[model samples]
Target: MIIVITRPDFFEGEAAKIAQLLQSGRADLVHIRKPRASQSEVEQLLFSIPTELYSRLVLHDHHSLAIKYGLRGVHLNSRNPEPPAGWSGAVSISCHTLSELSECRRKPYAYMSLSPIFDSISKRGYRSAFSADDIAAARSQGLIDERVMALGGITFDKITEIKEMGFGGAMILGDAWR
Candidate 1:
């Protein structure tokens, strides 16, 4: 489960890059997380990508596009915490704490992201919130499992440690864009 998160804002040739990542199997899913973009802007970006690969795309905003384009899923975030009404497709949420993860596990979701596992590279002051002891305790209690993805400050080099920590995958942002 190599899940990559798109940059917050669209960049030149961004769609092409996303198409390549999915087409080449570099990412199992790519979450399109433009918090401030217009619906038309997001639509244009989606149009640029090949229709055959739509199943690998997950919209973080303008979730209507997911249904309109038959995309893989919609991501739940602060901007769009609740999924679209009556949406039964693949749904994923973000959880910053093990408690949140534990609570959210009752719902049927495809996966969830645990963030700030390390000091963030994208957000200047977002330091890690969990210590080794905390993570170990969570893992021992069956909190950090395969359904969880490690987000924030994730890079290719840290994948081994992430896997060892029992994460299903890593959701890279700054390192990916850089």
Candidate 2:
């Protein structure tokens, strides 16, 4: 049940076909993280996906749009302190540390992303990265629960290690879908 979270920069060309392939594969979730995408663009992509795949679709930091379009939910970053109230859909937050994870625990998100399990090309500015041992320690410390997801530098090759570390899943950016 590997999940593939898509970044807009990595997925360009034949979006309809790509979306179909993404939905057809062994993906538990497909997070659409087009940070600057317009509402119309998002809707166009969302509607292209079949209703059966709706449960597996998640947006990036756009609760209003998700609600308006009847999409699954939104993924929030560290800056976003809280998910908007009244969102009944699944919400996921990105956390990089025990403190952030602790803060996230107070929120009502469906899951959390603990990133930098490996060095990441996407997050070039973040020098403080985590290893599997660090991730394990965080979990052991009770900073997060079993629903934590691994992000940042996660690839298909590392899926087994991620699962072994007791993470629920990994969020893909430049790896799986590319």
Clashes of each: 0, 0
Count residue pairs with overlapping backbones in model 1: 0
Per-model TM-score, in order, reads: 0.96, 0.82
> What digit string (tens of lDDT, one per residue) describes model 2 on residues 1-178?
4667666653445356446656677567788777677767777777666776676677775557677766677777654445567778888888887688788888766888887667775667655377556767877877645678887788888888878787888877767555
Identify the leading candidate in terms of lDDT: 1
Q: Residue 109 error for model 2, in Å?
A: 1.9
Model 2 misplacement above 4 A: 10-14, 78-85, 121-128
On the 0 to 100 scale, the lDDT of residue 177 in model 1 is 73
Please give the lDDT score for candidate 1: 0.89
Per-residue accuracy of model 1 over 92-153 as CA lDDT, tens digit each: 99999888999888889899999899999999999999998988888888888898899988
